[model samples]
Target: MGVLVWNELSRYVSLTASAYAVWASFWGMFFRKFFWDFVGGILRNPGGIQCVHISPISWAFVLMSRRPSPRARVFITVIVKVPFIQIMTTIVGFFILALEWPLRPVKGTRFHRSIPLRIFLLAFQAILALLFYQGTNASLWSLIAAVFYIRALTLGESIGPWKEQRGTVGQV
Candidate 1:
């Protein structure tokens, strides 16, 4: 199950190799989709957004903490909890990149004007996918990417830098 979920994580791995990875990841998600459908007892059911295992932060905290039949509740909790953990880490990883490396150029120059953030993210995501499996834990990579992305996105505009060059206070 973990491998299936792990393999399916590509759907969220939109950082790089987007075109190709998308298809692969989509199929991966499809597997989970069915499992979720079965467990949820319906198709297209949705779950709440919750923080990782440190509950009180979990959406199901009240529903899960106590129950009439602990076994059924436990099973239900595991199903949702597992996915929650995966998504949490994935989001954390994405932000890690978002905060540090938006990869935007500061001035209207060669790379800034030419490169699209999507293309760059596509490549970066691909690299991260590889790292996700072999690099270490997802949390580690998530933090790494978060740092890289935040810097790039936040200060990537070249025009803003140009404003400074022109002695204008461009509050970017």
Candidate 2:
């Protein structure tokens, strides 16, 4: 029963994460504004700017920007919301959701964590994603999804020190 509950919870986490990737990728600045409004209370702390646990893609922005200031956050926050980036993210999110459906049964198991299996799943999904999204912007987006999805699955959901928001989609 505990295992069943754990699997269900992981499934919800996967669903929420995939939805967030789609919404954040598609909505652009509107999603940022919505995010700020929802988390406004937390950002109000005078001591330090709070780092939001968000999409792994957003963390890439943070690392690439490489500045430890609020300006970096502002820049990343805005950049990530760009329509092009958002659309790509949405595409990747869709792929994640599609792949996730099959993973529901094995979630939270060591079998799910096996490197060989992960490679196989990623290869299968990437091929399908490439074919599914071909002749469109998603062609490039599939590459991005391949990297992020593998990292998300292999490294765990925490992109860095920030929190991993499993429910960002539902909240937004």
Candidate 3:
């Protein structure tokens, strides 16, 4: 009975991880399209705007006001709501990056981004996924989850250097 519960839990965990990996992959791949431009807009034009108001009700109204067909209007609405989401996401990202070499000072390599450290994070996640497997019952689900996670990580890594030049928010 204990073994049954453990395997069941493992299966659930694997499924959740797979879902997370897919979510991460989408965010990682389309971050620029979904977020960077909006965030870039905020940072570049900080001009005396000390506070931001995020109104979900207003956003819902905006969405309802549209004909619900044009991609451009949907994109604009998303952009309008993005700054709030960006704040939370950026905070999480900062916390994660802060644990690494370039962000936080450690024993070695003070000046450069640590490739080995990044690789180690990926490896650790893979090992974690392997640990989720529970003998013959669990099968390849854990491994598949790990693969997805690793791909998401790599896709995330592809979005390098978040800075945009001053006063160039919407320029091509």
Q: 57-147, model 3: which lDDT tens digit per residue?
A: 6643221111222443443343332433323333333332343323435324422233334334433433322221111122234344334
lDDT of 2: 0.41
Candidate 3 regions exceeding 4 Å error are 1-112, 134-163, 169-172
Give one digit per residue, the lDDT tens place, for model 1 in 1-172: 3323321132233343232333333333332321322232322225432222235565453422222233334433433333332343344345424422334443444433332353354345444433222222332333343344444455552212223335557755
| All models, RMSD in angstroms | 17.0, 17.9, 20.3
Whole-model lDDT per candidate = 0.35, 0.41, 0.34
How does residue 149 of candidate 3 score in lDDT? 40
Candidate 3: the clashing residue pairs are: none
Where is model 2 poorest over a 10-residue stretch in terms of lDDT? Answer: 128-137
lDDT of 2 by residue, 1-172 (tens): 3422333344455555555555544444343322332223222223233444446765542311122345445533433333343454566566556545545555545554443443444344333223211212333443344455455555454212223348655687
Best by TM-score: 2
TM-score of each: 0.22, 0.31, 0.23
**TM-score between model 2 and native:** 0.31
**Model 3 lDDT at residue 130:** 26
